[model samples]
Structure formats: structure tokens, C-alpha cells
Target: MAKDSSFDIVSKVDMPEVTNAIQQAQRELEQRFDFKNSKSSIDLESDKIILVSDDDFKLSNVVDILESKLVKRGVSLRALDYGKVQPASGNTVKQEVKLVQGIAQDKSKLVIKAIKDSKIKVTASIQGDEIRVSGKNKDDLQAVIALLRKEDFGIELQFINFR
Candidate 1:
């Protein structure tokens, strides 16, 4: 009998990187000529990022800065679920960007289905916030990973715990 090779698929973010990106965006916001008197701000909340500015245009600029910082830190833009820009106090606009940190139930199901439909000999089981995929062959496991990577699950996925 042969042992099964396996790996775990998970959606997670490096908090330290996210924090560093936020700090960098903040510094840039403070020094940017257009934002100096615009009262633009980018705040990192518990699980969401808040962008505030005098209007939608400035708010979008703040988001662009934050996204660039995140990209430079190797974070995926898909990990951010942006909300609508809404009116705030004093004629300001605010936008909430939710950080996607876990694989939702439906998304996990989609992953499993994709693997199954790929005709690859692998078993994918959802484990809490992650998915465990096991197969008899390492090449099959690699194939599974490649297949998953070709699809957009709307969340940033990391493959770990290969054994």
C-alpha cells in the first residue's frame, strides 16, 4: 500500500505585511501633494480597511495607494472585497474594504467541484476554513494545485502542509 500525498488549501493573509502596507500607504497619503489638504485617510480596522476623503475621487485615490502598497507587499488584490463608496459626515466619502481571510463554504465547495471535474484522482475535503486534498500520487496532487490555480475563486488561496 502507498501513502497518500496531500496538501491543504487555505485563504489567509500575512497580517504583518498588511500592516506594513497600511503604514506605507498612510505615509504616502500624508506626503502626497494632492492629499495634503484633502483630509484623505486610510485606516486599517480589525477585518476591514476604511478610506475617507473629501469626495469620491480622493477616496478612490486613497484606495489606489493602498492597493499599490499591498501589491508591493505581495498581497493579492482579490483578497480585498471593496464596498460601495458612501457619503460621510462633512461632505466626505467613505469606503470600506473587507479583507478576505478564509475560504467561505461555497467557495470551498467550488474548489472541490473543480478538482473533481478536472478528472484528477484526488480527494478534496473541506476542513473548517480550509480544504484538504489527498491523492495517491504526487503528480496528481500537483495537477490538482495547477487546476485550482487556473480558476478564479474570488479569494487568494495558499497551498500548504504538503506531505
Candidate 2:
């Protein structure tokens, strides 16, 4: 019997790189003239980033600086999902941005369902935070990759560990 080929589908982010980017952004915010006295700040929590500012314009500027830092650190914008902004007391605004790492349970199921619906003669299993698809033919797996890339999930996906 011929050896089967397989690939692991995952949406993962390097936390260390993200942390470094955040740190760099913080430094820039502290040193930048516009931000130095703006009373705007960026805070990184467990799974989310909080951007606080005196007003919407400052908030947007902070976001832009953070995004530039992320790009410099090689982090994809798709990995960071932005949430709606809300006004806080004292004429301030706060925005929460989520750092998505790894596929969630619901997304994993959706991926498997899509593969099955495509009838590509491949087996897809949802592992912890990832989906593994296997098939006898490499072409079928390549097709799967192409199909997945076309779908918009709002998260950056990477095809890894292909055999």
C-alpha cells in the first residue's frame, strides 16, 4: 500500500512575537510627541489588547501605531480581530482587540463539515485546536488547501506539517 499524505490546518500566532510587537508599540507611544501628552495607552491582557484614549482620534492613532508595530514584527493583521469601540466616562473611548490563536471548537467543526461537503475523498479530523486532513493522493490534499484558502474565516490560516 502506498503511504498516505496529510496536512495539518491551523490558525496559530506566535505569542512571543506578538508580545515583542506590543512592547515596541508601547515604547513608540511613550516617545512619540503626539502620543507623549495625549493620555492614550495600550494595555495587553491575557487574550485581548485594550486601547484607551481621550477621544476617538487618539484611539485610532494608537491602533495605527500598534498595527505598524505588528507588521514590523511579521504578524499578520488577520490574526488580530478588532472589536467595536465604546465610549467610557470622562469623554474617553475604549476598544478591545482580540488576539486569535489556534482554531476554536466551532471553527474546527466548520472546517470538517466543509471538507465532507466537498466530497473530496479525504478524511478530516479535528484535533485540539487544529484540523488534520489526510488522503492517499497529494493532489487531493493540495485541492483542499486551495479550497480552504478561498474561504474567509477572519483568521489567518496556515497549512503546516504536510507529508
lDDT per residue as tens, model 2, 48-147? 9999888989899999999999999989999888999999777789999999989998888888888898899899998899999999999999999999
- For all predicted structures, in order, the TM-scores are 0.96, 0.85
Clashing pairs in 2: none
Q: Which ten residues in a row have the lowest lDDT in candidate 1?
A: 35-44
Residues 39-156 of candidate 1 have per-residue lDDT tens digits of 7888888989999999878887888899999999999999999999898998899999999988999999999999999999989999999999999999999999888889998888
Prediction 2 TM-score vs. true: 0.85
lDDT of 1: 0.92
Whole-model lDDT for model 2 versus the true structure? 0.90
User: How many pairs collide in each candidate, listed in order?
Assistant: 0, 0
**Alpha carbon lDDT of each predicted model:** 0.92, 0.90
The candidate maximizing lDDT is 1
How many backbone overlaps does candidate 2 show? Answer: 0
Kindly give the stretch of ten consecutive residues in candidate 2 with the minimal lDDT sum. Answer: 32-41
